[model samples]
Target: MQGINRCPPVKIFVGLLFAFALNVMVFTQIYGQEAVDSNIISYTDKLAYGVDLSTDIDEFIVSGPDTENFHLVTNNDVKLTLRLNYKFLNLSFGFSPGFLSGNDDDELKGDSSFTEYQVNMFPGRFVQNVFFRRMKGFYVENTEDFVPLWQEGTDPYLQFPDLKSIEWGGYTGFVLNEKFSLRSLLNRQEWQLTSSGSFIPALRYNFTKLANTFESGSYGKENQVDLRADLGYYYNYVVSPKVNIAPYARAGIGPKTSKYTLDGVVDKNTYFVSDYGGGLQLGYNTDQLYMGIRGSFNGYTYKDESDNTISNNLWHGLFYIGYRFETPEKLKNLF
Candidate 1:
């Protein structure tokens, strides 16, 4: 990679603070401007604000140029995301702190002991994990086989000091008939459905980026970028005046790119990705306040056929509670 600059943990936290403050300011401004006519209607009640705490389980793999050898990598990420909505517009931003846990990790030291064993102690390290070893934040430690793989005066080992990364992302979307959090409650008043279901379609997009692993002598970096668009439908069934149960299904495709560096050589590739799944949503919605919980399971895989031999399949589970401000259609704007 050209350089190694770790994204401090503060970035995500600061971003969250900024997003929340901006939403608060927006709410105040909208409310302040409503003095023009308390009885006259100028704008629809089209605003929502909320936050979500989520966990993402990410899995990865490494193989040779021809995709011969295979190794499994995984990460557990926890995030705090903030969301805002106005009319058909939707926006969300989130942050995930740095954490590392994999093969040869030292639980006591909270670092990668793999670095010392592969780079410092092992003598014949050049023959093992050749591709994964040269990654930005990874190092080689000698296992003390006592014989150097290369000739005398040759040192193939490097130290990266640390091997951890932080991740952050944002999302934007358009809802045709309904939205999350706010829509569930509004639909109750608009349609006056006593019991039954209705269909709502949504268009969604999201992008995620993470810092590279290694510190120096890197060609490129190891990180991911994914952009997806999906048009999905949900059926909302009202169980009670205060509760609604919904079953949702969606299928979408996108491009997922990953970058890796070895010996100052960069291998960056973008693979066609596809995802499909369904889930259930339960919420308590009203004109002034709304609260809800949702759960979903999804499956994703790369379009590259070469990975078929290996288990490149990935899946995720989501559970989050959402709370948002709601305004009565009769009262007008939510300020």
Candidate 2:
């Protein structure tokens, strides 16, 4: 780790953005049109654009036989996102604007930043997603566990201002039932007129890097790769012609390969990991406008040698409003 950077370099981030843009163009050109069951699903064939306001809380819990459990968490923040959807391609970019008032109270929790780029494609019954995300800065969440008789309001949590994490991953899957439309629940380019459900199985893979600027650390830097098979059930209940409620749950288990660097030496380890998540979404859609809110909780856990375990848990909420309109000839031809 002598020459390695603590975070992904600027070049890699720029390359990822370019790759995401390239995929958006290729997918829109090739998979822009597809046939589906007319009764169960309705396609507008129009371009949709929108903005989303989201709030997320993420934390990591570490436990060992000899040490007490402690939590490291990022500062809670609100994020802004821009989204565009045309036919099969759905692309979004999210970032935290420094102007947001709440996150600036970093004196207690430390400062943090988050950014992500994601692309989703829906072709008939198949779904594909690719995403890259970066997060930096964290502080101890359970300060009481570390400081004796610590007052919550006055005491500052232990901060790791140099900690950073970067992850990139993708998943591909297909819908089991043709009657159920996953597109209606996700991108909102299609409308589901009837209540239906489907079983989705997908293959997911990701690479993650975790590092800190500390010169002498037990785990100087860690890189991990995970490949998992996930099975999920999604159901949409159409209460009215323009309103729907959807619920989804998923679980996955897989093997993780991790490489840890310490004092110029490297150690490799393998562990089995499990993850679970469930969420609810309520949406209202019309020919030209759409709005929705969603809430979800997700977590994954892995045990190392001798009962040492680590878990990452996240809670997220999102609200979005958007409009759809006929695709202009200029925009379609340009891509």
Candidate 3:
């Protein structure tokens, strides 16, 4: 009778021991899967290095220095960009090389000064653009130059930035869940995206400038600095394991806090800026590489010191191709 009683305790102990062992095995498997998932990206990752090519196509209009009747049309102004990124950090370098100048000749009405101003202003104008948003300004030293170039009785003069520029910055990311995350940036870049799906809210500060001389004393000196924030969101649709589509939206506002001198003239300009946009991205994802094309419509409205509102609208597009290099062939030999 004593032996039978003792057997019950021993049986209970074995049962508990088996259950604990089973739980440990299950936990180990889950941990292994999580570790693997963190290292490999679906359409995005914690670290990556890659390059991107993009451009902005702008259609701008100028109306009234005195009356609402003054109007001038500037069309198809293009700025080409090249970007390099490493994880949360990025650096972009851009130069003004105006493409599709075909109808630009007639658009300025054969006035050499207008043509000169339009051609020379592209680099600086494009460089001043922060995160695909452009500033509005006229670089004329004398107001008298508006005649013949503008409507005879009205006022007009503004051109794209013509110059060389360098942009450098960094970003940080946090995950909230499978469907949402947050990213914050302190840099000159814009639009942080993922292929699976995510909502990213961001904050930023940007400093943009124009070069006094580039390519053997070409381009001029102008600079502007600004602070801004954006609320961004996107969702992904899967077509296959390797391909997907993402559509996104963003809106933001801030202020232009600094001014610069242009051609012996101090620019007495003050600005309050607002921007919003939407776009789509198509991507192909794999273990070692990811690439995609994205297109978006971007608009910016600026209120100057005179309380005059100016709007610039653009179709911005980007092409990206990236390959991760962290897991080299030699790493597999460590085991």
Error of 3 at 189 (Å): 17
Q: Could you tell me the TM-score of candidate 3? A: 0.51
Q: Write the per-residue lDDT of candidate 2 for residues 1-335, one digit (tens) a residue.
A: 23455455455546655665676567557866456677555544688898999887788999998998989887757889998898656878888876787577688888888888887876556788878888888889888988998888687888888788889888888899988889887788888888999999999899998887673554478899999899999999999999999999999999999998866698899999998899999999988999999999999999987688999998989999999988899978865
TM-score of each: 0.48, 0.90, 0.51
lDDT (CA) per prediction:
0.42, 0.83, 0.44
Candidate 1 — worst ten consecutive residues by lDDT sum?
116-125
Tens digit per residue, CA lDDT, model 3, 218-315: 33454656555766676666667667677888888877654655445666455777878898877776656667888989876776665556665777
Poorest stretch of ten by lDDT in candidate 3:
116-125
Question: What RMSD value applies to candidate 2?
Answer: 3.1
What's the true lDDT of residue 67 in model 3? 39
For model 1, residues 160-276, the per-residue Cα lDDT tens digits are: 334543334333333333223223332221221344333333333333333343345344345666676664566667677767777777777778777756566767878887767
User: In terms of TM-score, how similar is model 2 to the real structure?
Assistant: 0.90
Off by over 4 Å in 2: 1-33, 40-44, 215-219
